[model samples]
Target: MQRIISFLCISIFLISCNKEKTDGFLINGNLDNVKNNSLVQLFRAEGRQTVIIDSTRINEKTFTLKGKIENPDMYFLTIEGIKGSLPLIVENETIDLTVYTDSIFASNIKGGKENNYFNDYQEFIKKIRTRSNHLTEEFKLAQQKQDTSKISSLRKEYEVMMEENDANDLNFMTKNNDAVLSGLILERALSTNKLEFTKIKEIYANFDEVVKNTRAGKVIAEYITANANTAIGSVAPNFSGPNPEGKTIALNDIKGKITIIDFWAAWCGPCRKENPNVVKVYEKYHSKGLEIIGVSLDGTPQQKDAKQAWKDAIEKDKLTWHHVSNLQYFNDPIAKQFNINSIPATYLIDAEGKIIAKNLRGAALENKIAELLN
Candidate 1:
């Protein structure tokens, strides 16, 4: 009777140990051609901040990480001195990865099912980006050579490629609605203005409850809800901030004129490039009752340099107009009120404060201003 009781106790202990092993997550990675003393850092993004979780030194070009997570979440693996970090989904299971120092994106991530889906999507995006870059180069060369026909053809091809990419992205989201990766993909699509509000809502609704409960999923839902208030035909959301000279300005103060609420940032290359056209338009129409409020998405109080950068950009671009910002990059209250996910976004409000149009750029912007004012 004593021997039988001892055997039962040992069996239970062994079973408990086995359960713990299966419940915890492990990441065993082998890196090819990594530097002898390179350090790989693991980070998890929470809200707007990235928190470092752990760091490991490369030994024999291999490393291991172990932890337990309640559910799948995105984590980043970055090597010291690398330009970009590799993103992967970590779940409560063992995962094996093989990375080459030269090209981390092409690295193989095996074991985690979510990571597999995420990797496939990343590969697809890489292919599309390569093609887009090639076409952009060709278009620039054609423009320089004054080859209008070739330029037009390339432009058409570029548009087709973009449409196809969008279609594929939508298809992937729809097919993988239950996967956490779908939420991540949708969040990115929302930020890039690739998904309309209706489609965003639809895709979000189809997401699994677990996916919808994730941090990224909550952000997507919130963005869709906030954007509904700023849609065309809706009254423009009211906001205010300090101008460059430290005077408070309100959106209502700019009422009774055709106002362009320009969302931009000092660090945004596209915004800087688009500034000349905006300056031209402001110069042409400021006297014609057209007003622009440049809401800069620059600098937090923590980043004093962003304030100087904002001032420098305004001076260099000759943006002689009302400008304001809370100086909180992407966390500005006004930007949140208006659901601004990307820079270089604009809302054209009429005299009545109704949003008349959105994202009107270059010739489209000039044409819209002319039509409204003239």
Candidate 2:
């Protein structure tokens, strides 16, 4: 159960398509059960960012918020009273959101395309549950019979079903959708909700032109273009900043060498923990022209504590490489340009300044460098 919850959490992060809406849905609940001073938040997605548009409270177990939103995206009906939330897709139509402690129910307060979407989503859920059960049964049978060949065959069959499921889902959104923004929104929502980031990337890669040619094509096009440009295999965007010694150094200046750009912070425990593997790689590959560039997202350089934390880490880990920092934290120009919101993000750029691979660590990191440098 814990593993399942963890997987769901990962999927939620991957597929969160909270889009900003001009209007919010109507929420109905028993407020007496909720603790005082608790708040409920409404969320939406704008381009690559998720925005919280409105928040309200429940009085005596009943409260309603009414507003219209511009774009369609995922909305959550959250209760500060409890730890769980309900996933909602808010559109131009009015919706009646019903909530409980652990489960939620919603209805179309206003009818039309939005209503159809909810109905379709319900069906999608049903199908997914059925498919998941079927896969579980097949796996159990294969294991009980000790049939290795059958297990492989069952796995292939399960994969084919998942593809069919994706196709069915896409068809549902494209067929009935008249609004250009609607399709893009649906695609983003489903991709995120279904934990299908790879599919999201593929959609941007293959159907970019189609998305562009559509009514809201420009908005969708810009998003896809920006994402694809920063994706693996493209040239890493160039920038320059002051190194630890307060000297100017630029990515372009390091041309004709394999460069690993690591966006990290001293406060980020994962980044500090991963430093040893990075040191090992640097020591092994430095002779072969491998360069490690550390971009720190610590606060102001005036904050001696933050700066010293990094300095101490370097000394302890023996991370002898090219380290630099603007000391702007997430607001650092390079991080913003790269759209990096999380720490411990990594990129491996080739001699030509083109990004080759990314987010490698441990054995995978070692194997990749060994393959390329050796």
Candidate 3:
């Protein structure tokens, strides 16, 4: 069973041929158990940012919110004290909801294209989660009973389930190419190393012009462009940043026959933990035409002395290699160019500057270097 649970919503964009309505959406909600005077809020999520769009207090076990949105996007409906937030796409239309306080996600939502998609996705996830939950129980029993055959069988079953889940996600993204939700899905796929650039580019190419014009579409379009240069088989994008001494270092200047571009920061726990492994790799391989550039994302508004922290970490960790940082945290130009949202990220390139691999760590990082240089 796939352990990841991603909520999805799909809706057909409803357009009126005769009259265009500038008026916004009306949400009519009913609380099943009658919790009166409680606050309800709506939040709009764009990329990693979120803002509340509308909010109201329930009266007589009911509530209403009216608002207009420039584009259709994902929105979360939360009632004060509700255990879970109800996710539904919000568009410029009348939306109806029957909230089940005990099971918020099970609440019926309809009346808009966004609601249609939300319900469809809910039904789809219901089946997937049900089977996955059952598998979890059986696997637990197998482990307790020391049933080796059953354990292996369940592992295989889980792997198959994961593949199917991935395929289903891709299918939805492909079939709903014209909807803003498709762009959102594609944007998520772009964030990870799961799909290759070719696949991503292919999907982006198929999106309708209208989809491309939406906010989500524009964001994904930017992601696609940034990833193209860093994707395996493409040349690594060269970047420059200020070293600890106020001197500058550029990727093209120090890139050896084999190179590793390591993005990390001092505040990052995982990055610090992985530092020793990276140090080990560098020590063993530096003499054999392997080089690494440590790009420190250390400067945040909260840090008292970002530069001192960067220098201190290099010395404390014994990171003896080319290191540079704009001290701009994740906003570092190099980090932005590479679309790096997480730390301990890396890219391995050959002498010609073509990216050969990415995000390798520990023994895998060493093994890949050995394969090329040794």
Candidate 4:
């Protein structure tokens, strides 16, 4: 009887062990041509920062990383001396990855369903990039030959291809709303500055609660909320800063005019290039109730002479307009309030301070101002 009881207990213990749930992730990775015992690092993106969570040494071209995660998040697996890093969604499941030196970006990742979906999205983006490169090369050739007809046709084709890509990406995100990858797709769409605020809001609303609650999803949601205030038909957020002469100028002070709130930096090449066009528009329309407030995102701890740089750029570019900067570089509160992640950003506000358009450049800017002022 005693022997039989012991046997029953052992059987129950084995069964329980077999049925035990795994609460953490196990990433089993293999890197071809990687030296044995080489250092490998894992990084997780929190907000705009990439934080290293763990590191391990590859043994015989293989390494394993284990960690607990509350939800799916973006992570990078990097090998020492490797030129590229492998990005994957880390979830609470076993992930099998194979990285090759020659094709690190195309490394094979299996296991987590989120990773699978991410891999698919990456493949689609790769194909799009390849086609875009081909189209660009053709465009250069057409330009060299001065073939206006070919250039027009190629430009139309490129635009259509890009539109189709965007549509497909949106569809994929909609269908996979439960996956973290969907949130990432939406974030990319926001960054493109092409999608309308209403459309972005619609997409965000369609996302599943699980996706919306992820770190990336939270960030996207916040961005959408921030953008809503500055979006077309919405009231532009008011701000105040010191102009070049060290006098405080508020957006409210410039109310009752067609205003272009231009966010730029002296060091930004694109901003510098676009200045002449801005200058042309300002000169043409300043007399017709068109006003511009140039906000400079120049100034860093290393550059104590940022104020001078801002003044010089304005002088050199011939931008004779109300210019302001806190000389806080990227840490400018106005930039943060407006969610100005990129330079060369503009908000066209009407007499009532409602944003009428955004990111208008060159001919677009001129045409819009012409329509409003005339």
Give me the displacement of residue 68 in model 3, in angstroms.
Answer: 3.6
Candidate 3 lDDT over 102-202, as tens digits, reads 87867776554444444454556667677778888999999999999999998998788767766776887788777666776677676555777778888
lDDT, candidate 3, at 150: 100
> What does candidate 4's lDDT look like per residue over 81-147, in tens digits?
6786666677777777778878666577654556556556665666666677788789899999999
lDDT of 2 by residue, 1-374 (tens): 13223323222211112223334444434543566556877665443356776777766666655555554445655667567655555555444444555433332222445444445555655565567677778889889999999999877877776666556656654554443334444444432446354654454444434344553444444445545667888988888988867798888876546889988887788998998898898889889989888888887435568667767767777878877888777767787667566779889889988888888988888888888888
TM-score of 3: 0.77
lDDT of 1 by residue, 170-227 (tens): 8988998877877876876775576777889999999999898887788887787778
Whole-model lDDT values for every prediction: 0.78, 0.63, 0.78, 0.78
Please give the lDDT score at residue 76 for candidate 4: 75
Instruction: Give the Å error, residue 203, model 1.
Output: 1.5
Q: TM-scores, in order shown?
A: 0.68, 0.59, 0.77, 0.70
Better of 2 and 4 by lDDT: 4
- Report clash pairs, candidate 3: 1-158, 10-117
Model 1 segments beyond 4 Å from truth?
Answer: 1-25, 31-37, 44-50, 66-71, 80-84, 100-103, 116-165, 191-194, 245-248, 265-292, 300-304, 312-321, 339-344, 350-352, 359-374
Report the error of model 2 at residue 295, Å.
3.9
lDDT of 2: 0.63
